[model samples]
Target: MKIIVVNDSVYPLTMGGSHRCVFEQCRELSALGHDVVCVTANEAAVARVQEPGGFYLSTYRRSENSLAKALGFITEPARIIGAILREKGGEPVACLSVQMFPSLLGLIWNVPKLPPFYYVYHGSYAREMWTQLWPRFKRSLKVSDLLGALYGAMMIPVERWVLGHGRFPVVVLSNYTRRQLIDDLGVKDDRIVVVPGGCDTQHFSHSAEGRARIRARFGVDDDTSMIISVRRLEERMGLDCLIEAYADLRQRSEKKVKLVIVGKGSQRDYLERFAYERGLSSNELAFAGFVPDAELPDFYSAADLFVMPSLAVEGFGLPVIEAMSCGVPVLATSGGGHSDLVAAIAPQCVVPQATARALADALVDIFSGRTKLPDRSACESYARQFSWGRYCSGNLAVIDRVLAQKSPPAQTRA
Candidate 1:
C-alpha cells in the first residue's frame, strides 16, 4: 500500500520522542514492503532525508519571516492542503498520517479528496500549555501569564472541534492520551486505536561486554552506583524534583552514587543552579549534555538505574523502556503515560509525582539492595513486545481497516 506520513518534523531533524516514534513507524512500514513517503519541515530536511532508508522523504520549508510566522498561525491548514494536492498529483493517496496542527489542516483543506487519514494524537498541547500556565499564575501574577492562558483557552475550542469533526481513525501513543481524546475531546471510542509507542528493542538491549566497556570509559568504579535521567531539561520533565530527590537520597545513603543527566534544553541554567543550591558537588551530579544516538546505549548500560521524574506533559516515557531493554531497573513517576508503561513492567517502582521523599526512598531501596530489582530477563521479555516492527504493523492494520470501511465523509457546517 502507498502511504504518505505527514508531520511538522521527522527524525535526525528533531531528536525527541515524537520524532523518533514517527521515524520508527516509517522505517517499519518500509520494511513491511509498503511504499512510504514522509513529508517533514525543510529546516532539517536535507540531513534527515539523506539518511539511508527505504522510504522516500520530501520536505517543505516554511518561511522564517515575522509576517510568515504570524500568517502560519492562521494558514497552517491551508499550507498542508496545498502540499497534499501537490504531492498527490492526480492519483488518490490511500492514507495520511496527520497529527496536531496537520490533522486540522487535513480536515480543512482536503475536504472532498480526504483519504482515510490516521490521526496520531501524541498528546494534547493545549492541556500541556494549561498545565504550565497554572503553575506560573500561582507563582506570580503577570499580564503575559494572563495572555498565555487566554491563548490556550482560545485554542482548546478549535482543538476540540477538529477532533470531534474530523471523525478519522485516531492512533494514540498511550492509553492516557486515548482517554483524553475520548473523554475531553468527544472523539468516538471506536475511532480511537491505542498503539503505544515503541523502542528499537534489539538495538537497545544490553550486552555484558558493552556494559563493561561503558563503565570503563566513564571511569566508574565497579562498586559505584549510577543513576541516569535521560530527558530534556524542561519544567514539565521535573528534573528539579529529581535533583531534590537525589539530594535527599544522598543524605540517607552511605553508598557512593552519581546522577548522570543526559539531554539539553532551555532549563539547563536553572537546573544547574538548583543542584548547586542543594549542595551537590559537580562530581555527584554530572550534566552530560545531549549525548548522540549512537552513544545512547553506552550511557544506558553504564547506569545501574534510570529514573524519569516527569510530573506531566508526557504522552509516553520512551526512556523507561530503553533502560529496561538495557537490563537497567526503572523508577518513574505514577503520572501521565509513564504510569502505564512502568506499571506494565515494574509496578513496585512507580512512585507519586513531586514527592521527592518517595523518589529518594525508591532510589535508596535500589542502592541498599532492600527492594528486588526488576528481573533482567523479564525486562528483556517485556521490552521485546514493544518493537518498532510490531508498532508499524499494528498501525498499518488500522489504516487498512479505516480505508476498507468506505464510509462517506461527514459534512461540516461552517
Candidate 2:
C-alpha cells in the first residue's frame, strides 16, 4: 500500500510521543513492504528526503517568527495540501494517515475523489491547553492567561469541526481520549478506535552493563536508589509535583536516593528554581537536558523506578512503556494512560493521586518494601504486548476499514 503520513513534525527532529508514534508506524509500514511518504512542517527539512527507515520524507518550510509560528498550525497544512496536490496531481494515494492538524485538509480538500484517510487524534487541544493554563488563569487572572483560556475555549469548536468535517475514522491512543471525543466533540463512538502507544522492546530492553555505566556517570551507586523521570518540563506534565515529592521523600526516608530528570522544555528554569526553593541540593537532584534518543535506554536501565506525574490530558504515557521495556517498574498518577498501563502491569505501581503527598507516600511504600512491585522479568514480558508492530496492526485495521467505506457527504463548519 502507498501511504502518506501527515504530521506537524517527524520524530528525532521533533521529540515527542506523538511524533515518535507516527515515525514508528511509518517505519513499520515500510518494513511491511509499503511505500510510505511522511509529510511534515519541519523548517530544517529539505524539499524531499528519504529516511533511513525506508520511507520518503517531504517537508514544507515553516516560518520562525513568533506570530507565524502560532498561526502555522492552520497555515502550514494549507501548504502541505498544496504540496501533496502538486506532487500527486489531485490523485488519491492508497491511504492518508493524518496525525496532527486535520483542519485545513478536511476543509479545503474533502472531495470524494480523495483517498480514504483516518485521523490519529492524539488528544483534544482544548483540554490540553485548558489543563495547563486554567490554573494560571485562576491564580493570577493575567491577560495572557485569559487570552490562552479563550484560545483553548475556541479549540473545542475547532476540534469538533475537524473531526466532523469528513466523518473520518479517528484512532486514539487511549480510551480516555475516545471518551473525550465522544463527550466533548460529539464524534460518534463507532468512528473512534483506541490503539495504545508502543515501545521498541528489542532496543529498549534491559542491560546490566548499561545500568552500571549510567549509574556511575550519574554518580549514583547501586546502593543509592535512583528515581528517573523522562518527561518534558511542562505544567500539565507535573514535573513540579515530582520535584516536590522527591524533596518530601528525602526528609522522611533514611535510604539514599536521587532524582534525575531528562528532557527539556519551557519550564526548565522554573523547575530548577522550584527544586532549589524546595531545599533540594545538586547532590539530590540532577537535570540532564535533552539526552539523545539512543542513550534513553541506558537512562531507563539505570533507574530503579520510572514515575509519570501527569496532571491532565495525558493521552498515552510512552515513557512508562519504554521504562518497563527496560525492566523497570513504573509509578504513575491515577488518570489518563500512564495509570492505565501501570494498573495493567501491576495495580500497586500506580499512585492514588497526582499530588506531591501521594507520590511521596508511594515512594515511601516502595522503598520500605511495603508495596511489592513487578519483577524485572515480568515488566519486560508485559512490555512486549505494546511493541510498534502491535500498535501498527491495530492502526492498519482501522485504515483498512476506512478504505472499505463509501464516501460520505461533504460537510463543513467554522
Query: For each candidate, what TM-score against the reference?
Result: 0.86, 0.89
User: Which regions in candidate 1 have their CA more than 4 angstroms from the true location?
Assistant: 42-51, 62-81, 86-91, 102-112, 130-150, 217-219, 407-414
The 0-to-1 C-alpha lDDT of every candidate, in the order given, reads 0.76, 0.82
Clashing pairs in 1: none
Q: Write the per-residue lDDT of candidate 1 for residues 1-414, one digit (tens) a residue.
A: 778776666777777788888788888888777777776665432422424668877665655442343234345544544555556455556777875553355455545656667788877766655666656655557656555655666667877888877767888878887787888899999989888888887779787777778666656778888889999876788899999999999999999998989999867888999999999988788898988888788788888888989877678788888888888888888866877888877788888655788888888887888877777788778877787777787898888888877766788999
Per-residue lDDT, model 1, residue 129, is 56
- Best-fitting candidate, measured by lDDT? 2
TM accuracy, model 2: 0.89
Stretches off by above 4 angstroms in model 2 are 64-67, 86-91, 102-113, 130-149, 161-166, 407-414
lDDT of 2 by residue, 1-414 (tens): 778888878797788899899899999999998888888777665666889988988776766542244356555555655556557443347878887653334424443345667888887766676666667677667766766666777776777876765478889998778887888778888888899989888899898899999899889986899999999887888999999999999999898999999999878898999999999988899999998989899999999989899888778889989999999999999878778888987998888889999999999999999999899999999889987998989989988888778546678996
Residue 303 local lDDT, model 1: 88
Model 1 scores worst on lDDT over the 10 consecutive residues at 65-74
